[model samples]
Target: MIIVIEPDSDVPIYEQICNQIMEGIARGQIKPGHSLPSVRVFASDLGVNMHTVNKSYHLLEKKGIITIVPKSGAVISSPQDFNESSFNRLKDEFKPLIAESLVVGMTHQQIQNLVTSIIEDFTKNQK
Candidate 1:
């Protein structure tokens, strides 16, 4: 996986790492059962602190996107690994963003189109 980190961006480095990894998963660059680089190696490659990568991995674990095995490394989780609670958590997370979009005068159609476009962009390479 190629992760480009902008040190000057407002987004934290760990969050950027997390987002890129998630995007990689969406784009099918990293499939289920794929092993991620070790935190030390990834940090060295990315020129970031190991702690940052660890935080990102932990966050991914918490989000059910990956699992950290003892003495093994991180592995991508399959969709089947997600339970109802995971979906509920996702809904809860999206509520504020959707509400904010509506409050900002975005129409339902516009929001839907944006979502469709993002999904298409993410999955285009899979076809």
Candidate 2:
């Protein structure tokens, strides 16, 4: 739930928000069914515009990571919500990144090790 925004970074504010939220979920800091702060409150806390937070929340919703309800705010989606199409879409998205790594002279083993390390770092405390 700790999100640091670098105003001077190349990434957009809304993307930074979305990435941090996704990372929080991956690290188990934000569990499934957890409710996110209201857009107004989150924007106030992050010192960003409410529209930025809204855009981030909507992006997360579009990716099936969270559900936005009118009165209840945003809730993390459960694992059961993911399906084969989601897996395929994610695989397709990763393809170019993997290809880029290879083109940069990164060996397959090195890429796999990096992925493993990241997964371990994120899930270590969950169990």
- Against the hidden reference, what TM-scores do the models get? 0.96, 0.95
Q: Per-residue lDDT tens digits of candidate 2, residues 28-96?
A: 999998999999999999888999999999999989999999999999999789988889999999999
Give the least accurate 10-residue stretch of model 2, judged by summed lDDT. 1-10
Each model's C-alpha lDDT? Answer: 0.95, 0.94
Error of 2 at 11 (Å): 0.7
Q: 1-127, model 1: which lDDT tens digit per residue? A: 6789999999999999999999999999999999999999999998899999999999999999999998889999998987999999999999999999999999999999999999999998896
Question: Which regions of candidate 2 deviate over 4 angstroms?
Answer: none
Q: How well does candidate 2 match the true structure, expressed as C-alpha RMSD?
A: 1.0
Evaluate model 2: give its lDDT.
0.94
Error of 1 at 114 (Å): 0.7
